[model samples]
Target: MAGGFRRSGQQRQPKLQGKGTLEKMEREGPFKEWLGMPDLYRHTLVIDGDTYTYQVEDAELPFAPGDKVVFRYKEVKSGKWIDRNSLGTWIDPSTYNQ
Candidate 1:
């Protein structure tokens, strides 16, 4: 998963705790790359009935589909696994530009 703000259930409080004024700014930070190459293997997080695939290429980084993985382009750029339900949305190259 991208290294940024992640949504949690009501049981867990927000990570970026502060007044409303600064909360917005705090939410925005480094634009995490989610579509390079797989690095470290992170556990799978199924969200909204979608089975998202995650894996590690090197051994210490984490990455997901559409999201740039940790490794640079010099290595394997893409890998694949079966999406049984195809629940998650697939992002095209054009969307990444925005």
Candidate 2:
């Protein structure tokens, strides 16, 4: 229910790796909270002017806006809906550049 319809306890694998500037993180909506469900948020990153959204499970990802980061993600498709799900640890910017 975060990015796409993941069956209860279903697992996902990263399809690719991406590096970019983390621009923002925003809660998807209050609808879930209103329904007494868990809160979920999506993170936005910009790479070469292209913006991507990654569904993040962590309430407190270490990276901040304007910080460079590298992450693994997988695209999930359910019907016509597509979403990017963040996987694994977010590589430290200093370590990533070197």
lDDT against the true structure, each candidate: 0.29, 0.52
Clashes of 2: 0
Q: Score candidate 1 by TM-score against the native.
A: 0.18
What lDDT score goes with residue 11 in model 1? 48
Per-residue error for 95 in candidate 1, Å, reads 16
On lDDT, the candidate that comes out on top is 2
lDDT (10s digit) by residue, model 2, range 18-85: 66666665545322434665666654545435556655454555666777666565554521111434
